[model samples]
Target: MPLIVLCGLPGSGKSRRAEELREALSAESGGERRVFLVAEVAAGEGGGGGRAALRAEAERLLSRRDVVIVDAGNELKSFRYELYCLSKHTGTPHCLLLCPGGAPRPDRPPLEAPDSRNRWDWPLFTAPEDPSEPLPLPEIRAALFERRPPPPNQSTRSQPLQAAGFLHQLDRLTQDMVAALMAAQRNGVGPGQVIPLAVEGLGQEPPGLLLSRAVSLAELSRLRRQFLSYAKMHPGEGEENLPQLGSMFVQYLNSNLL
Candidate 1:
């Protein structure tokens, strides 16, 4: 499954755009998939903590399905990156659907003071301000909400091994597969082409009949290595990279797992 994170500031129409995306995806896919719209309010007792809480909630929600749309005011680069990482760590494809608004300060009101007593949620402290622009609220909102076909090379359905329990399953499965591949390699098989043999033993069939697609043994090995590398290199990065890496791993598994 792939996760789409809608990023914008308050009054950026993220909610409306998210709904439109959900409807379009469902209609195109025969209305068989589940799309989650996770929303959050930043006005609670804990101001900036709401963002962290939203990230946690998004992570937990990801375990439930393949297509999740996070509706939030993601104005910070760090936050967007975190969403990407979460998708990668969970083995789900992740994309940033950004809504660039023209408001001087999309996240905050133009006339508001830093210490203003407005009870509404304040925009991110780091949001950029551009004074020369006229807000493109309608244009951006229309573009964001309009229904469109899936991007080139994107899968129509969620990939397998993306569930909450996938990590444990993959850990055990990868150990066995590696062991089998190593055994084969020891018997004179090339190390550069070991994933096909491993794929033969995966219990679950690859999603969208990916296994049936034409693929070379060398390509399979490369993909396998990519997956391993993503898992190993991800922890060193910030939380934002997790979803991106997780999604990439899931795509690899979905395309190679037999």
Candidate 2:
């Protein structure tokens, strides 16, 4: 599903373009695609409506698996941003269509133009003034359908670390923790002892969990290797899920220690 947002001043022919796009998209897909049109949030006094209400309506429509065309004067950049966020959150494709046909009122805020510099405003389109110009079907199709991957965000790009890097770190981190545990064992720790977990860059020890009575240097090495193998094979070992590697290893060791 893709959300096509129409933004411009009132009487800017946004409604016309929205309907035309709906028709063209439907006919082009041989009615296979469920095309929808969400008119302005409200035809209230002076054509004013709360952005919250509009966003809520758009979000509800976008949650469904339908190609939605928001027919409204999305004059504010913030309003468009909301639409963009909704699409991203729903994992749906989206683009902005600027219908530049109406005059701005001095009584209201001026329209903040869509800038290509903004990622959310990309794949932007401008409606032809003539109203008879053909739809940019090729461009629209490529933008809405070609990009199958979800858009990246702050959380996704929080770290440059990828899966391969995470796996490498996983191996190194486990090796270091295991070494620390083995060194603790050499200090004459007995059965039912709690291991003092320490590693490079750690200001404090990890959880002081009970160690197994059967724990030996050789046994710890074997268990560490086994855990490394398991971690590498685990599907959920993604970079973002590895915030507490030391703690995770400590938990793993304690679980097996019992």
Candidate 3:
């Protein structure tokens, strides 16, 4: 059974649509497949806790012969991504139902709780005077609900390099390393000069993992070796210097060689 997450701002008919879709799915699939509608508010007091509760509910529903529909205003990208990851982890197909119109639901009363860490504040999603029409069923099925293929070369050996911030720095370092290598090669400078030049290029720490992807294996190995050698020579150097060396090596590869 697949999990469908409906995300939209408040007054966008997410709850109503979820109900309609649930009925449609149940009717289409027959009584053999049940549909569980779980709301975050019923499970917790805070948004994070609510999300965790929703994840747990989805996890439990996965074992049953049913399709789980999460009816909530999941406006944040991070929340949606986490749900996506959850669905993948549970080995269930996932779909996102989005209502772009932002139409107000007259029947659904406003949430009374204050917008704080403890409670959810249903934000107003003011519909445009002439709201754009919803995407066609074919397009929605193809674009929004379609399953994405797993990435190529999914290996456990390269796990540490998957951090986004490290990848970004790795990319920058690859370019710099490549440049230094090229410059050294051109000027007939040996490995001694090339190593220091590469180290000097990779100075700052990367931003954050949420913003980038992993560096390739070839790049990682080259950087790792350079840093290990550097560490051997400068025993008093902080562990933080290791990543800088890695980044420089990657930068060199990206810019000059690959």
What is the TM-score of each predicted model, taking all chains together?
Answer: 0.41, 0.56, 0.45
lDDT of 2 by residue, 127-152 (tens): 88887886687888888878673554
Model 1: per-residue Cα lDDT over 17-81, one tens digit each: 67776776666557566677777663221234566577777887774244677777665443454
Model 1 segments beyond 4 Å from truth?
42-46, 102-258
Model 1, residue 117: distance off in Å is 38
TM-score of 2: 0.56
Candidate 3 lDDT over 1-258, as tens digits, reads: 666677665666766676766776678667887888877666562434565677677667763256787887665443454455555445455666655446435422222222222101122122222334432334333432355522222222244433434444544554555455445455554432323342443445431111022234465456445433322222223345446445433332322221
- How well does model 1 score by local distance difference test? 0.47
Best by TM-score: 2
What are the clashing pairs of model 2? none
Residue 12 miss distance in model 3 (angstroms): 1.0
Flag regions of model 2 displaced more than 4 Å.
41-49, 152-258
